[model samples]
Target chain A: MEFPKHLKYSREHEWVKVEGNVAQVGITDYAQSELGDVVYVELPEVGTDVEANNTFGVVESVKAVSDLFAPVTGSIAEVNPQLEEEPELVNSDPYEDGWMIKIEMNDPSELNDLLDVDEYKTFVEEESK
Target chain B: MAEPGDALRRTSLYETHVAAGAKMVPFAGFEMPVQYTGVIEEHHAVRQAAGLFDVSHMGEFEARGPGAAAFLRRLVTNDVSRLEVGRVMYCTMCREDGGIIDDLTVYRLADERYMAVVNASNIGKDWAWMAARKGAGVEFRDVSSETGLLALQGPRAEAVLAGLLPGGGDLGAIPYYGAQERTWQGKRVLVSRTGYTGEDGFELYCGAPDAPALWEALMARGGGEGLKPCGLGARDTLRTEMKFALYGNDIDEATNPLEAGLGWVVKFQAGEFIGREALLGIKERGLSRKLVGFEMVDRGIPRHGAPILAGGRNAGVVTSGTMSPTLGKAIGIGYVPLTHAAEGCEIAVEIRDKARAARVVETPFYRREKA
Candidate 1:
């Protein structure tokens, strides 16, 4: 339930760590925990453009399928290479090695609409209850 | 999911599940555990070691009196007349038009008595179907509320079960599809050799009040044996790997055994049974659609309600699907036109509105090596 202070989050449970023009994206630890044992992650290829709040990929657990929503609109610069063979990393290291994509931000100001760590924590608490 | 005012039923193991930190969800009108540690972990536990499941929500009914065997056979598609005492048979009870009512297992509990284990969701409807068809020489009893069931399934199921029996002799005496009357702490218990998972296992039926103790004793004995308390989530993946037809998903009121690849259970030779004529007619006319197992050739995972695509057009629909924990790949069951149901037949599943390459393959998706 720890939301890293440096990362920005969305109500859909995605996290973004923006450095300059590129934003690194992945599902939060809380998201991975709720959808247990992620067996497959279908991600958009590099260079593909994605829009804010739209589905960019699908994360499948053993019993359920979930959409991975884009927290910020951008073009995909790079995708995680390890996830194709080791999707379990999403559950094992959701914040680091499980980072899904790096987005070249189309509208950096969209970051204003996303939640900060504290706001995301409050959202998770209320949604779970 | 239920309405705000609706109350879901709880099994006798409810407290134990909660105490073990299980994730609970609504299933068949009961607040049942969907997972404990995790679905994939439990699935592997069942495949490699052992897993215990609280199947108490399933219903049990007993029919007694003279000619009960004959009466029972007439209600289902299988010939129960040949079932010896302590033996069990799997079959489906179908409507007059060959539509499936529910698939169940019948146990010959005594010379003039037979018991049926049915899906929990269909308890009331199944009971009414049976009662309406009861003839003069048979008396029926619903023991569902008074009974509790637990399924211990896996490769090590025998060892785990034998440890709990003390000096009860070799469990090998109970062959597959066999049931023996026994006791747990001096209460009547019926142990049957059967399971939905593709593994050697046992299903124990006991008095509802005895369930808590029975489960605790099992946990105590099996904890060291790598026994994980499994839930409906793992249960689905396990059964899906075996290609077992779940009542609500794979087969339902609108589906027939002949078209669902369950024709082997529809025996017409032994005697007259319900749906015999309709099934016979279906067989003679040939099935227009057939249930087939398919695995994705590409990345996407197919799921229930996903359209089955053949020749770039909608041909059928997926009934059940999952990324198998054991095989580590996406697999699903779907009904496709007979023209596209052959092994190696090319088909596609529409995943997220896109056609994903797939092919029909032989089922079951996974089978345990014979001991």
Candidate 2:
């Protein structure tokens, strides 16, 4: 429910924090809560090329499995190694320690296609209703 | 996934489940709660303390008449004649080819009457199957829509039930698989010391109209003792930990009782049942494949339909798998070639496109020590 003003979100509920040419990606708090008790996180290997709106990995909960979609096109620079041993981090701290991958943006202009904080909040509210 | 407009059926406790913030999902054509607080929390509560579940979606059928017992004996694999009044026996109904129709529990309410509780999804199918085989002198009644069932399970079940239905003649005296008729808040209810979870528990069967009131009473009375309201998610994990065979998952029409490791319930000596001849032949010919329990020696959890491999050859497929809440590790049940089904045998489970090392182990992965 908490959509931070500084982050951009995708329709699939992933959030991206933009910096100078580099961006950090993780699923939003809403996404983590919807998928309960995450048991395993499968991430793409580092140095892999990931395109915007494509699946980069899988997130598995006890009851279901969901795809982790990339919000923006990029070349993966770093993958979250901590998730391999403790996937519950995604449930506990989805924004900070649970950041899945860091991407060197292919074209920062793609950020304009993503939803801002207010728009993402409205999207979540309407989708849930 | 069920369509959004599929018109899922609701149980009598539907409102109560919603009010408690349960996550409802479409299961077996019913809108049932998959979890209340959380699956793991509810699972641990039942293992360490107690939990209550609304199992009203299950079906109940009544067979009554002078020939009721005999009619039932012809359909199911178990010996229904051995069940005394106020006792229950786990049984399986199979086709003529030895394929299981459904696994159920037959309750002997009286000398000339019996009730069979079956899976919710198999109610219509099982009803038609039994009705087509009905003989003279017996009346069949489909009482499923009018009945309500609740399972209060865990180690502390007896103490909690004693508080609600006081002076019920020492409920502890009711042995496992035993049933007794008792009055609860003015309604006659059937109380049975039985459960799907491998624990000391009791199931309460009553009229549909009293379901809401009974659930409320159980929660209010047992809440102090940490009896959490559980859902189907925990029910699944608990049963999987015990390696209990689930109907559609572990055993289906394509699988027979002899190969599914349910031979103990098929009493061949008890005489002429629907699948007796085929099962007898199967027993004589030796099993081709066997259901075996396995635990992951690697990381990743195995899921339903995952292929089991022995030396890179397709051995079988996983029927049921879960991250056991009690054992804190991944475990599963699957069928494999008879030659590869022994304990400590090595096999790999295909998980996420990679074969993960797993070892065939003895069931039940978890067991509560008798106190």
Best by DockQ: 1
Model 2 per-residue lDDT tens digits across residues A2-109: 778999999999999988998899999999989888878888888899999999999988778798899888899999999988888998899999899999999999
Write one digit per residue (lDDT tens) for candidate 1, span B1-371: 23455688899989999999999998888899999999999999999999999999999999999968878889999878889999999999999999999999999999999999999999989999998888888989999988999999999888898898857436888999999987667788899999989889999999988998999898999988999899999999999999999998999989999999998888889889988999999999999999999999988788999999999989999999999889888999999999999999999999988899999999999978887
Off by over 4 Å in 1: B1-5
lDDT of 2 at B163: 86
TM-score of model number 1: 0.97
- Model 2 chain B: worst 10 consecutive residues (lDDT sum): B1-10
* Runs of candidate 2 exceeding 4 Å displacement: B1-6
Give every collision pair in model 1. Answer: none
DockQ of 1: 0.79
lDDT of each: 0.92, 0.91
